[model samples]
Target: MSWSHLLGQRAALDYLRSAQKSGRAPHGYLFYGPAGVGKRTAAVALAQALLCHQPPEPGEACGACKSCRWIAARNGLLTNHPDLIPLLKNPETEKEKVLGDQEQIIPLDTVLDICARLSKSPMAGPKRVVVIPEAHRMCTGQAEAANAFLKTLEEPPPTSVVILTSSRPEALLETIVSRVQPVRFRRLSAEDIRAGLAQGNAKAQEDEIALAAALADGSLGRAKELLEGDLGRWRTAVMKALERAGPQACPGVGLALWALADAEGKRLFEEAEQKDDEPAADGEDEEGAEAEEEAAAKTESGWKRFVFRRLLDLCEVAFRDALVTAAGAGPDQLLQPDGAKLAQALAQRFGDEGCSRMLEALREAHFATRLYVRGDLVGRMLAGRMVSNLRRGP
Candidate 1:
């Protein structure tokens, strides 16, 4: 019952429970799965069980224990428990080692430091848990950082437990993968997402929860993000704008969407500023200020891309619905039944060929995102391509 809160991860829970009960828990565990599907949650839960003082069973932690409360007391990367270490390189904690999104390579020094700590005795309990989120990042630069950690992973201390979580296990080195116990976490179902949302967010309505679950593509994190950020309303507004635009609605609609995404991103940024609990670092010189400014710019760019991707997802679904409509499918068969009007118009104008071409254009735009292209330029280019494809057809 220690894992009662983890929805859609029964297999992983069962495996961990059995491992704990059998007293055969490995020194290292590789938690592999898609994003936002309770991998981190399970890591913390397992850590709690291992660190608990009075567990009813070997693998299960009492829900009301001191260790459980300490593990649950997490803020950002740091937890209240000293023995539970969450290794993630963020700008706030490790400014010198900050890799950001462009080159997120965990440096060799970080691994050495963790290995040194693990060599010592546990501070709080019998077991020391080290959770490394996005463990695949260590595989970058010809796996330089990964090779550094391989030594410790191969021969870990008896008191230490390393939990490596990665959505892309294929990116990890084979040597490292062979050492750890692999526990797979699959993507959550819609009902799982809905249930998770209902438990965490009390303000969410039934309709919003259902829609978020449907559109999240099995990502509980994204479902919560959609509802929390009200991106659904943003999508509704975009669909409404294209209602009576000129044939194709290319550059105009595209620019409008880019602007909307930008605005929403800024809104989220301000919300973060309001909730910014971390205090500013003192004695910042001119160079430090500039570096902070540069980091801020990168963060803003990330926000734009994130919101734009969500918008593109909605548009893609709408167009996909349009294709179904062109193929004589009714609204019931459409993925986005609420956007039936827009789908009907798009189907009537572009027919099947244009919609297919447009999806290709969307794919190009998505690829552009990966390349760190400006969101506005990508939007305009996508729209221009859509217009050309539509005109060529009819």
Candidate 2:
């Protein structure tokens, strides 16, 4: 794969391509950006170029070459190449549940093992590439696992390069940040996202794509997510819930959001597990079931966290747009222009002051969710506030 294969991220692609042409690719690079802006894609593309047995073009990989083929074929996030090393955080352990770590630390043993592999000569290519797909969680707190891997980052083998990708660069350790070259990946523009969506197989309506683009907040990953997922339905649910909510129905809004997020989370977990494991027999031994249950709980927590957060994000965007609409803004000034009717209804029901207050309530709920508050509670709180702030006055 070549840089040309990845869409958007023109600036970042140019910088890395220049590094390859100049033969000055850094020993360590921190490619940080919002999720789905193409940091991981760049990492894979760059590695392919560096390891390609035959260059199809300058600073580009020959897709037909064995090196390029293996690199494109992924084992989870990492490539299949012998020279590629991935030090990933363990998802099976419920460290977040046990001690509130937010994530399990990258096991020190795994780091040491990868470092040991790096010490040897390159197994197949000119360089041994180290890719950390989640440095935000792994390299946080100056933890033992992070400290153990510091030596490799400080002075990698002459034939090796390290690439760390994270959406939360601020959370990484200063020492970790200082050692590597930094390349910032800005969010893709709306036009870029729209072009990408048009190329996809889903063949969604133009208006739907336009609405998704407006709501996407400049991340193509997020745009694709919103288009493919049930987030749109959740938004509609919120609208209908609030519009028809009486004393009895107000609480149901929160419960509905919670249940919807819970279901989405479960579906995501099941899909991932299916991708990771092949079909097995109907029944499992007690030990196997116990282990599977534990893994499910921990991994599902991460997935559910994202699902719930996305719901809140949609809520925040809708209410923010409603506030502007209430202030007499046109469709151009408001997001969800494709859903102007929904926004218009929201503006009429909430009015100016109510919209502002609901935004505050959503912000508070966002904070509580980050602190790992119960999802049901956050939903209930938001629902109650929306209902209480209701105004049908003349």
Candidate 3:
């Protein structure tokens, strides 16, 4: 839409506008921030302003111009706008068909394609804009692609602009990093997320929205997924398993956690499969089909990691609630206010020290998982240690 639509990025927007007004807009920009915090959206908006037939003001798109309309078409895919090139990992090649999954890598061929296109004159406007979403994905242990992209960044076309958006700037090459101006995007506040949810979907219940916002960790994208995925149910099940995790029930608790992971993994796989079954787009051919299959595999594998991470996050929240309750904090202080009673009971049973120990076990399990430990084994160990810790009085 317009710059106004991007929430929690006032500083970034202002900087861009100021640069535009001063005729000092950089040829290359690297927008780095937490995922789903509107980096891509802002990038597209900037492109629109740059390409607008009749921009209302410096750094502001009219949003109603033909160019703006074309940019907005297909949710900023900008396929028909020849002047704007979006060099994202093709949907058929992403680590997951969904966002917030594993890393999606940009292949060398894609980089070469952008280089070829940038060599041409703009078809629809005076300036051409190239956007590379998740630029960190360009690394992928591919020296050719990074080196090729580096050439363009070193001496970009005077009439064209390149914008790279990434959540993991550290993953990018130092050479590439030095060539682009950096625009930092911050995470959204809970209040801002809550407001965004209300604006996006007024029908959502206030309490549900509040819970999602609270658990979102400053990510509106995560908040939306929490609501859509009915994560509340999973959270309830996790809490119940924790409550029943006595020494005798430790195995059962582990099984429950495994079941939860399995169920989520299955659901994600089914979604990916369903997407794969859909008819190919207009120009898609055999190569596209192969790419889709590869992407689906990547998606399935990535979702496994995503599920494990989510379980860890839920565990952390539960233990934090217990810790707060043990400290006699008000119910309002609990992250999961819906589970206040359970948190209070847990605190009474395990005390603060036990909760702390359980949290430590979870952290260790998380670290081990990151270090390539078997997930199921880690879950079992965590379950066993949680039960043991809870039984060992303060």
Candidate 4:
């Protein structure tokens, strides 16, 4: 209901709470952290606390108030509130099937719209809360939009609060960042994650939960996505595919990797097109040419890259599990609790250094594919490197 609802990041919650209590709240606040660890949740909670009529804690929103109810009922902190300006991707319209916040990239038109909305007077509320989630997506062209918002931050509307949230804080302009108080949110613990799942009565295997938590690296949102099924399948599929492609005849490897790459590319494009909601027109025509170019500019490569990244991530988890074993840490300390024996075997075979080398090779292979290199060659090369390095005795 309050910032207390934000799992983990106790220090940040307390700091914001204390500032609210003291009435020393900054006009501009930045919440930066891994996605899905509740940065946006905390921001909204803080916004509600600021706007709440009868906040139990001086700065905390009472969650029971009309204002808080309205905020909570809204789809997103920025989207629903008249005062809250969300720079979220505009959904595809009947006329156009535009992307929705594609891979943390916010559209420029949305950025400008949010800026314009924030520049106006509050329609009904006492205070306006302007939020730009994925602020990093406010690209160079859109960064100009931040300038418009900056003046508001410098001299905010009476009782107005500006909240900026981003997973990639490094992409934000320094001037904009300097004007805000940064609150860092971290990943929730597996226990907290499990507790959250229990609240919803979600039926996910505990082992999968643990694995996703480890892969989340501190983002519960990411953990939730992994638990949703795609990431695990992607990881396992990539490993099996690579294993099959490697140590095969050159022609066979070519056929396998090409088929895999082309199939993945087509699937990604189709998913994107479906999301775009456009008719299946021939891509060679003038109208289709523009669509094709836009589609190409946006990577159909995301699917393959996602698979490769997940594979590399699995390898990293395996290494972390090996480290846990090597350090005499318990199975509970392992990222892959289900793979304890595999972790132990990996530890005996590769030790710490070799495990790192294997990960590096996998990453390099991903990079090579991105550069339009032959995927089969990269896969074979990476497989050879990992096998040579990891198959040796510690």
Candidate 5:
């Protein structure tokens, strides 16, 4: 729960500590960075320190204290602490929700509720801390939620601090941005991620962890997901499909990729269903069930996109490895070290130009996917292009 436990954010911690020591902690702070890079963790740690019954030093929270324990407690959607308010999107309306899915916008009602809470006196700690983990989702345009929240930011309570965290800070309102102090969180390096995974007791082997870190794009959250999820199995399947795909096998390869995507979508759907079946909290009603369905749909769509993107990344990495191998690169240069021999053989088959062309095709497919292109069509196009590219004369 201490800031020291947050790996790979030394600079951010230093700045926050200095601010605390100077007694100049801002009323509003924006912790902005990529997903899973410790923004929310840092915010929570800061809250604990601010509300700790006996803080040992500046920027340090006594985690064993009653106030800190309540803030850290997690029971369903709500935390045990009354003064520590977390404004997050609610997937189910029936529960006392604190956090939810990647919502499109923070509803106006939620913002008003937050304003009301801030108006009240502290229930336990010396100060109240409002943590908005995804503040960029605050409603814009005619909704007035962002505008409404501005009043609280403009004239914040004397004993309250608002902490806003977002991966997409550019999407936030200009006025809102101006009102808050910005704290930048950088992505963790591969070594940093590897160390963290080890510390977290990840079950993957060292090589597997290294591969995941390389593919994680500097996000610890992504690395952990890659380790715990089906990325390893899917990666193996992709390699096998590439090796088996001949000029006449484009349709078959495309079908295999389609199956993978379909299976992932179904898995996500089932998981959401299971979560829905969990009994609702005290105040939840029938309308909450309807919200759950909507949330499930959104989750499924997002999960599919993530799967497709990862598949595309695997394709890019494979082709890049092949290109490097064809140019007489060493094994250390390979992205997929676990499949080095396979990658080398594929490089011999495709040669330099073929690998380059395949990489370009994969890039185009990735762009198309981002533009909301149908996943099946993209898979088919990628399969056809890989076959055609590999079969062409040098």
Candidate 6:
């Protein structure tokens, strides 16, 4: 595949392609971005172009070539190509694994492994490429590995290339960043995400795309995660729970606590982790490293946080709809889907002041959650207060 396949990050592709055509391709490069914006894909395309035996002009890989075939196959399976030595965390323990004394990531052991692979003559290809996903997972102690890799990056290996991908590049050593040319990827657009979902034949609605796009904040991967059946369900349930907890009785109650108590909720939490294909360093064996249970709990909490924020937005929209309806505004101006019924009911029961109070309760709950207050309890209390206030309108 060519670099054009990368959904966004046009400037990055142009720079890499220019380097290739000018025969000034750097030995080491970094592709950094939020997860799932096509950093890995771009790296693979570059690798394929570097190794393609019959490269059609400079910077373009003949996708039909043997080298391209291998790269494509590898991409399909998300495996490291022979020319590319991926710096990855130990899968078994799920933390950075140190191969040698140098605790730096892409430790000497891994770098040496790549060196050995590169030492061999090409098998019908001009160069060997090493692509490291989550390259920042390299341990600081593995500085020796980084140093070793740096030597190769600076000299020798006529046709060898190293590409590093990371969502958290700040975790990487400054030295490493300075040595390699950096390529940054931005989040995909909502339209791009919709096209991708369509291409994948995913079961997503227009509203679903809008919600996911809003929540994803640019990452197509995140948008896809939002489109997942579980997230959609969770979003719906959270919205209902918020509505149930209307202003006053206990306004905005601990809805997430109830939401997370189910088996499906736990399963959804686990699925969220699976979405990130990149693993952490072998920190599993390290002291004070995250425990599985603790990590799982954190993951679940993150899911709750995400769902809760959406609920807050839904509440505001519903309130806005109530206000608009109370003012005898057109349906098109309503924000909530049940705008007609809720608006009429709200106007009859609470009047405008009650609607204002309901908004205040939600705003307070949101602020409390952001301040690290107990989110579930705060949510429940907020819901109760909202419901009570709605019922006992001013």
Best by TM-score: 5
For residue 331, what is the lDDT in candidate 4?
89
Candidate 4 has a TM-score of 0.73
> What are the Cα lDDT values of the candidates?
0.73, 0.69, 0.73, 0.61, 0.74, 0.62
Model 1, runs deviating above 4 Å: 75-82, 86-103, 142-145, 245-248, 277-298, 391-394
Ordering by TM-score: 5, 3, 1, 2, 4, 6
- Candidate 1, residue 267: the lDDT equals 81
Q: Please, what's the RMSD in Å of model 4?
A: 7.5
Q: Residue 24 CA error for candidate 2 (Å)?
A: 2.4
Better of 1 and 6 by lDDT: 1
Better of 4 and 5 by lDDT: 5
Please report, as a residue range, the 10-residue window in candidate 5 with the lowest summed lDDT: 285-294
Clashing pairs in 2: none
User: For model 4, what is the error of residue 28's alpha carbon versus the real structure, in angstroms, after optimal superposition?
Assistant: 0.9
lDDT of 6 by residue, 212-331 (tens): 665555766655545553545655565555445434423324555335433454566787578556674332111111111122234566555544554565566666677778788867
Candidate 2 wrong stretches, greater than 4 Å: 56-58, 75-80, 86-103, 141-143, 200-208, 245-252, 259-309, 331-333, 391-393
TM-score of 6: 0.69
Q: Which stretches of candidate 4 lie over 4 Å from their true place?
A: 1-5, 86-100, 103-121, 139-143, 196-201, 230-300, 319-334, 344-353, 363-377, 390-394
- Where does candidate 6 stray beyond 4 Å? 1-4, 78-108, 119-121, 139-142, 249-252, 256-263, 269-394
| Model 3 lDDT tens row, 137-197 | 7786898999999998887888888888877799999999899999999889999888878
Superposing all C-alpha atoms, what RMSD in Å does each candidate have to the true structure? 6.0, 6.8, 5.3, 7.5, 4.9, 7.4
lDDT of 4 by residue, 45-77 (tens): 777777777867677677777777876665232
lDDT of 2 by residue, 189-209 (tens): 888878877766267777667
Higher-scoring candidate on TM-score, 1 or 2: 1
Error of 3 at 35 (Å): 1.6
For candidate 1, which ten residues in a row score worst on lDDT?
284-293
TM-score against truth, every candidate? 0.84, 0.79, 0.85, 0.73, 0.86, 0.69
